[model samples]
Target: MEDFKFTISKFLKRTALVLVFLLAVLFVFAPSFSLAQVNTGIEFGAYTGLAQTDVRIIIAKIIRVFFGVLGIIAVGFTLYGGYMYMTSEGNEKKLETAKAILKNMAIGLAIILSALAIVQFVLNTLLNEYQAGPTGETTPPIGGETVCADCGFLGSVIESHYPGRGAMGIPRNTKIVITFKYDILAGSLIQDSNNNGQFGDTLGGGNNDRPSAAFKIYPTTGGESAAMAPNQFDVFLSVDKRTFIFKPKVLLGSALQDTNYTVKLTDAVKLADGSSAFGAIGAYSWGFTVSTVADLTPPQIESIIPTPSLDKYARNIMVQINFNEPVDPLSASGFFELASGDPTKNFQNINLAIDEGTKPLISGNFKITNQYRTVEFKTADECGHNPCGQTIYCLPGDKQILATVKSASVDSSNKPQAQITANFYDGVVDMAGNSLNGGGELRINGQNKIVLEPGVKTLNQWQAASGKILDDFSWRFLTSAILDTTAPKLTVITPGSLAEKIDVAAPLNMAFDKPMAIGSFKEIVLKTNKDFNINYTYFGTSYDALGQKVILPTQKAVRTTAEIAHGDFWQKSPTAPADTESAIYYPFAPSLLNDIYQNCFYPAVLQNSPRCVVGDISESNKLNDNTPSCFDLQNTNYEGYCSMGEPCPLVPAPHNP
Candidate 1:
């Protein structure tokens, strides 16, 4: 009990001394406050006391004072307990209570000191550093997919770098380039017109009239694995601020022989957000192979004109075999000759010359052969030039015989070039095996006819006879290619006008510009009234298969032209074929009436025919006049009805026709 009391007394003495020192310092250096300043209700002395020190120093002093006061109270209890213990007068219970009080006071002081030590260590190590701003060691933004951490953000921040090609790779031996397409919202990039460094008024928002987009590239292979070469690489690009397409070119200098090179994009070349190089846009990467210097050969003629295979009417022609590459004039001249065919024409007597004075131009003549006889021809060549040249150039020879030298034309370039027009006078065919048909005499007047050879058969008789030689080959050739074999367009309506008045028994159906396909009209309906606003349903077949009949299908209860007319009018009904059937067949103009609808007995079938009619033989009315007659069943014969009155019941239903 005595020891515990002694410890508390010592702590109290130390605290009291510290308090006395603080009070002395305050009294010596503190300033006086004006009465007005003290009007805040705090004592002037307290203000004066606080005024002597800075805020930090004053705060430390305040804490010291609080602890000092606590120490004083603790000391007072301890002394009282000691006094009680000293006066206990041999009573053990009183002595024990004094010891207990002294023990609790000592424990309280120990707890306070321990907490102070912990707080001091934490402030020095953590809080002090936090108060300082970020140093050079601060972490910088790194490459990764980025998204807004805060709420209310709908758009994304993506990098625009393009991958060379296949995911995460590019050819190490070849150069590659990439391009991009973007639809970036311009509103997201430049909202503030006044602020240079800032985006929109709100952070991360901006005007996006033209948003940010870019592309980048770097080495993918060989550059790092082997010794690097100087001046061996260069980046050639066509790029704008928004997009990039670059080709890496390497000068294959002596250091590196022939080898492929490649480049790739890296993390360092990307934007802060690690998005694509194309700025949230589409991109593509492509590569091309490069080759050393080399030469190219000319195209070869696989077969000759007047194709070898003969057409039925094919005749007289001169054809040649071609070479895979340009020929050596001297060697080609000697080697090129018309091979065998009809004995009438031979190369032995024809003039042969080197036709290559003009590099690419070449041709020869077979005029020395029997001019009246047809001949088949072919030619071949011995290779001359070296690089990419052929040792022997040959082509499947095509043939054409000269029936006559009609009008001819040729390319202006320097070469023995000529185009011949002639009939298949002798029915001669060239090498490749195509035949010709007859009735195609040459267009030229004098060359149209040719004398037939002794044994040659004429196309007209399939025998050796000659007349106007035909050029069916050219005609068929043109007809089969450029000229459309499709049916001629029927653009304008037939009969030309729809306003002309005609008999009511039959109506002139409209026509179109093009030939109607077979079987295209099963549901054609004819209408009444000039503009076709009011109508009749003519459920009948088309008379001309090539005529496309337009129909209005839904109306089943429509009235006929006869019913719509105010006066009596009638004409004979005729069976007509529909558009579908017309496609496969053509109709001749009717011989009974004029094509002029207004001057015919039957309006519909009245195209280009003589006008004739059969009605009351006893009546004094003309059938072609406005008083045309209608058939009446009661009469059992053509009689009695007239066009100037009400319509007669003699008109048959359209389906029946």
Candidate 2:
């Protein structure tokens, strides 16, 4: 029996050894299997699967290991308990205690088995459904580009995260990934500080020396709705790896309020086909309300046309207070006054009309008689508040108010006949309680009439007169010469009406309204101012050969009645003659004649009876050829009687001799 027991013990020892060996093998291989469970892809589902499986599996595996260790302990305890029980021969209490210990060990083993069974059942029902696919491949979490529709933000692909879209749209601080089809030149991405919807100082050009670039994520007036973004985004060329990324600490509200945001890809500047650079592609402008609110009130004045300073002669008629703005009709009219009688009390109502065509001008025609003089006006705001401290004068400093005293005609008696002048007040107040203290000068016809000496603040009334500021005056200033507006009129020379013939030798002098320029005369124009008619032939009295003067042949010949009957004598001179009234004379011609028979040679013949005697020579030559009496005696016997040496003696000088 002892031998049998010994053999049984050996067999039990071998079985225990074999179980220990198997447990060691399982422990060694279990870590490898667990590592397999940890394998995951860069995907949302993978992250979820790992999150869900890792903890549970690792915990259960740990409990399983604890159970395995406990099981070995239970077996060892059982053998030890039995050995104790055998050694307690005849000791009832000790044997009973050993049996109790053995019983407790068995009970503990049963409880562990039951609990493990319960856990396995729970895991089978809950986690088993999440088992590896039939292909034995675990699916990883899926992640991709996600856009935040609510806040116009985007998010990057977050692997292993469930609900790839951020919880509440994209966070304001997400970095944006601006991916391009082609690589972006790093230097090309320009940061616009002015926010003028452009990228660079030169409007659209950019530096494009580098391969990739990046910038902080921000909203723009133009962009894709579904693009994912990081808090900062990198712009990279199409490459195996990202090129550059920009990171910025984005202020959620302070910096962006009331500011416009815009952005663009510089790569668009370059394309296979020619394309527009920046603005053509369109800039993205997203407006945000900055913390600061703007409140600015336009300039204002009470009265625009103001009073002019008084003088012995009235300076300017119109009392105007040029308002900084178009005054409310009801509130504006009563502020003006004519300060002629009383310094502070006399004020008048002024008419108002906005100058519409080109420039900002307000014009009104006002009446001011000689008795009423100084024009004055005050400007006040609707609330009677004058931005120009209430000293009746407005100053410039944070405030802009202007006043103008437009000029108008005064009574003729009160206006200066020789020099018309007007005055404008500086730092003058208006109805809106504003003043004109700065900018530009008091100009007349575009010229700074009043140079605005350092102390001169108010612009005086603009003075105008018929000749002072007329078009002629303007032309004079421009060309530095006087221009005549009224044309010159002519009046006949004064003389008693005379029927009697006047002497042609008398000089005729005429008068004119104004003195003419000295050098304005020309050679061909004849006038009575200088030379008179005189015959050149009459100047010579004697001939070179004969004691009497001989007539030299002139290209223009004298005419007789017979020549006049042919009707061919008038002709223009080849060269224009100098301005002179000279007469041509024959040797025996009568040089002196009056207006009655001046121009044509026909009238002069009848006026000069002595000159007709020369024609008798023609009769003598034609009739007798020898003796003057012979010709006359034959003429008497044959036909009409001929006077000796007379041409056409009976034919009445051949009708024109």
Candidate 3:
């Protein structure tokens, strides 16, 4: 029995000694570990995985467990000292040993109590204005002072959150995990000091007045947020009690697949001894995308017109973007960047979070058409310094007709340059709910660059890699300053109006001197002598340049009374207008016609048209009126008063009279 007792005593003494050593080690290493980086301040955690916020919480938990062991050791010391006092039984040396043990314990207890009292008093005095909490817990500082994210209240500390700030593509069925940091507050997020061992029905939620709101997850514009529901999501604590998982009965069934879900950690959830996730740094909130199908594939820029190069491009060039698939329009807006210099080197990965305030260098609106697969941005505007945020306004006769990539590295001529960068960065998602890999980039010579040399002597060029879908297919082009004002003219017409027998089934085809505006051509009317109007329609027009005044049959086709089947059109009855002397052209509005430069059109005589025939006199009379008289003056006398190849001027006038 004595041996067994002595062995037990020895074990106790060793455990106590080891606990003291651990405390010493912790004190020495604390500063380094406590110097934790603030990871929750950002939005992207997938690249870095398993958030750094989790890291800090885990470290805190290990320390808490170690300190808990220390408390057990302290209790052991008190019991051991009592046992020795009972066994001493008036023995001088044994009594002295008992006295020493008791004295040590008393001194330790005194120190612990004094520290607690001083800490409480100082904190209360410093933060006296704050209203006491529901459970007499230490509330946040009274007046809106900055809340410390790392501070503990009473003796407990907990600070962890999820969807990890700006995390994206979170599965709709995944759970919301919040590290509780301690097991004492198991089924709740509040202190349980007075309850001893019993769990409570209600836990305190800080300022929001709703306990379940100590943490919440809601769609950006829907779900319980629109109509409040109590305790819709059930909370579960991990076996170790360091992590809290929130699970909705069903998966997020929000209105759409790309619904935004934000998880907010309110200051209401307190630890067992009473402290919220850093007492008043507002609410710790982070958002993530809720997608039904897991979209791991990234989106890429399929094509961009006026590619990155030193090739000449029109100043009024229409910027077009083609994606592999349709993307959310908002995701692709405000990310198109334009600059005069090499913005290539300074491009940044745009944050897709909606609240990110990064604005485009130029101002413009995006138009999505072609079934939403293409985005068009018109960059034309009035001449002004900084119009559309340009550093210099475009003016006529500028030496560099087009805007060119200019850098301090290049000297002399500021050759024409243009650069276009398109980003669908704000979580642009395809129909499949797959997000564009924000990783897509435009690289120039191992760097993100879209610099164009003025194509003065040679064309400078670059091509983005094709490995990933999100990679940008961006480019630079030399610019042109020329304005187009020449009007489009009809150079030829089929089915000559003077023909004796015109094929009633043949469609009248009019060719233009240039690629005439399709809208302008609609103004051309075919009318009979009876004035019955011929109705015709065309598909949308285009802006391709032209030279030889000949419109392809594909370019212009008239709707004959009997029409032939063609693109976006079918045949009409040839007898509909009733055959007559001719069809006259009257309603062609040149002023409404414009070239690619938005230049207005001017009227010109159509070489010939079935639509109109200008009035004219008899052919012989017209010829005589235009012909010059065949009379000449002779320099020398010749036979019969006329010389070969000389004018018989006097005789001719006398004969005419």
lDDT of 1 by residue, 317-370 (tens): 123222222221111111112443532232231122222343221123221111
Tens digits of per-residue lDDT for model 2, 447-520: 42322222222223211233211110000001111112221111222221111122223222221222211111
Question: What ranking of all candidate models by TM-score puts the best one first?
Answer: 3, 2, 1
Which predicted model would earn the best TM-score? Answer: 3
Q: How well does each candidate superpose onto the true structure, as a TM-score?
A: 0.16, 0.16, 0.25
Cα deviation at 266, candidate 2, in Å, is 15
What Cα-based lDDT does every candidate model obtain?
Answer: 0.26, 0.26, 0.36
Off by over 4 Å in 2: 1-80, 89-104, 120-657
Q: Native-vs-model 1 lDDT?
A: 0.26
lDDT minimum window of 10 residues, candidate 3: 403-412
Please write out the lDDT profile of model 3 over residues 127-222, one tens digit for every residue. Answer: 222221221112342223212232222112322333443456665644455543354345344223334442221122311112254566677566
- Alpha-carbon RMSD, each predicted model: 41.1, 54.9, 41.6
Weakest 10 consecutive residues of candidate 1 by summed lDDT: 577-586
